[model samples]
Target: MSGKFLPTARFLLIVSLLSSALAVTPSAGAQAEPALQTHDVPVAGGPSGEAAQRLADRLGRSHTAGIYLDRTEHRFVITATDERTAEAVENAGAIPRRVTYDTAYLDSIKKRLDTNFKTPGTMWGIDVLANRVVVRADSTVGKKDFAALKKFLAPYGSAARVIRVGGKTERTSSAINGGDYIENGVVSCSYGFTVRKKTDPTYKAILTAGHCTITSGTDWRKSDGTYIGYTTGHNFSNGNDFGLIRAYNSSVTYYGNVEAEGGTAQDISYSRDSRLYETVCASGYKSKYACNSVGLKNQTINYTDGSQVTGMDVAFICRDHGDSGGPLFAGDAALGLLSGSNNSACYSYYQPVNEALAWYGMEVF
Candidate 1:
C-alpha cells in the first residue's frame, strides 16, 4: 500500500474527505479569526467555564500567559518565551503534548511522503481536532509540494479528497507582523515591516499583533521608531489577532530583509512556485534568531481564539512575544509573516505574504 501508485488528483481528494470527516464542534465565530479548520469536525467532550478556571491555574501564567485551546480539539497549547519555558510548560502539564518532530503524532513530512506524490519539505497537517496544523517550515514551497499532499490521505477514508487553495486557505499575517512578512504572526513568528510610502527611511508605519498592541506598544519598536497607531481593531478569543497600524506619514520603505547580527538586513524573496524543502532562518526579539526547514505551506489552522484560517502554515520550533511580527525566509526569498499562534511556543503560525499585500494595498515586488 505504501508504494502503490495512485493518481495525484484522486489522492488529494481522499485526504480532503478524511479531513472533512474529522470536523469537531468549533466555536461559531472561529472562521473570521483562526485555523485548524475546525467546525468541519465535531468535538464531543470539553471542560466548562468553571473547569476552565481550575485548568488555568494548573497551567501557570508564566508558562501559559498566552496559551489557549480550540473548542474542537480541546487540547491546550502553552506559549513560552524559550525552549526552557517550553519544557517547563510540558512538565507542569499545562499542555497535553510538546512540539517535537517524529515524537508522538506523525510529522507532516512523513505523512506526505507515505503517498506516491513528490512533495517538498514544506508539507504540514491541519489538525481538524486540535484546531491547529502540525506545521514546520523555514523557507518556501509551491505546486509540486501541494500535488503530493492529496495522495498522502488515501488510508484515512473514502471520499473526493482534493487539496487546493481556497479563499479560506491562506490569510494575511497581521503585519503589525508581515514582511512586507505577512505570513505567520503565528504558529511562531509574526513579521513587522516598514510600511512607509516609497520615500522615507524612518519607518513611518509598522505592523504587529493586535494582542501585542493590547498590552504594550513599545515592546519591539522602541528607539528604532515611535508608535504608529493602536491595534485600532483586533480579534481575540475568537479568530485572528491582527490589527491595523496607521502612521503620521508613509516614511517606511522596503528595507527588504530584517536586521540580522551586527545590524545587517537579510534578503528575502518568496514566490508561489518556491520549493518546499530548504534551510531557512528567522530574526526577532524572542529567540534573537533561529533556523528550520519549510515542511509545508498553505495548511489550515485553529488558534486559541477558536477560529480557523485556511492557508496558514506551521513551523517546527518555538518563539515568543518580541518575535511576534517577524520574518521567515529561505536565502533571499520571502515566505510568510508572523501571526498569533499556539501557546506551545514551539509552533509558530505564519500568514501568506501575498494575501497581506492584497488586503493592505501594499506591494512586495
Candidate 2:
C-alpha cells in the first residue's frame, strides 16, 4: 500500500473491473455501469515556489530574510540583508530587494523574547515581507501583560513590531469524540502522514501533533478502542509541536495517501519547507480537507495553557476541535501539521513537517 504500489494497484483494479464487465452479458434490461476513466490529478505549488526554495537553500537563512512568489508577476522575490547577498540572489536568477535585517537577526530577536518575555496568549513570527519580527497578543492577554510585552520590545524599535488579535490559542484535540478519530485514551486527535525511518525501512510510524502525544508512553487507539500505536517521541515544548508513533502492527500495509476534497485521496510524495503566501491544503478529523494560503513562517506561539511552540507557521485556513496533528500539504509535498489556532478558529498554526521528519530521522512513505 505504499506509494510505489498506488499507481500499479489502481491500474490493475481498473483492468480487473473492465474484464468483469466484458465477461458479463449485458442484459438489455441491465443499465450499463458508467464508464471509468482516470483523470489526472492537479499538482499544487508551481515552479515559482520551488525556485524560491532552491535559492533560499543556496543562500542560507543568515543573509536571506524571506523568499516568496510575486503573485502578480509569478516570479520569486528574495529579500537580502547585504549588497553581496542581494547580488548573489540576482545572479541566481531571482529578484533581490535590500532589507535592513536578515533572518538570523530576526531569529535572534525571537530568541530574546523566548528567553525573557514568554507571555501566554501571545505569539510572534518573522515577517519577511515587512522585514521585522511581528509579535501578536491575542484577546486573552490582559492589558498589563500587553503593556509589559510592549515595553520589553520597545528597545528593538522598528526591528520589532507588536499587535493584538481577537482570539485565544488552543490545541484542537477533543475529549468528546465519535466517527473514525484516533485517540490516546485521554484525548482524541486527527492522524497525520505515515512515515518510515530513513535508515530502517521496516520501521514505520505515524506523525501527529506533539501535544497529542505529550503524555509519553501512552497507547493510541481508534475510536472503537482498537490498538493503533504508541507514542515513541514527542516534542510539545521549547516552541516545537510534533510527535511520532510506532505502528502497533509493523507488518500491516500503510499507504501514503491523504483524504482530499470530495472524498478523494491524494498521495503524498515528499516533505518540504513552506513558502510564505503559498497556498497549501490541510486534512483533519474535524475539518476534513481544506486549502488556504500561508500567512507567516518561523512563528513562535505561546498557548494559553502556559505552553509554547516555536518554528510554527500561520495559515488563513480554519480548523476545528480534533483537528490537531492533521496534515498540511501542497500538491504532493507534505508541509506541516496542525498545532493550534486562535480562539475564533479563523486561522491555524502548524509545525513544519520537515522539521519533525529531520528530528526523528524519518520520511513520508
Please tell me which predicted candidate would have the highest lDDT against the true structure: 2
lDDT of 1 by residue, 1-365 (tens): 11112223432453354234223222211111112211222223433323333444554533332334423344444444346756765554444433222111233433343333323333245332222333322123355544444444455332113333211212223344322222222222344544433343343444455455444332333423432233433333332444445443334343556655444676533323122223345556554556543334455453333344445555542455446666655555455566644322244566555455445554333
Evaluate model 1: give its lDDT: 0.40
Which has the greatest TM-score? 2
Question: Could you tell me how far off, in angstroms, the CA of residue 177 lies in candidate 1 after the best superposition?
Answer: 17
Question: With candidate 1 superimposed using the best TM-score fit, by how many Å does residue 62's alpha carbon deviate from the native?
Answer: 48
- Name the runs in model 2 displaced over 4 angstroms: 1-63, 82-87, 250-253, 343-345
Candidate 2 local lDDT, residue 130:
65
Listed in order, each prediction's TM-score against the native is 0.42, 0.81
Q: What's the residue-level lDDT of 52 in candidate 1?
A: 35
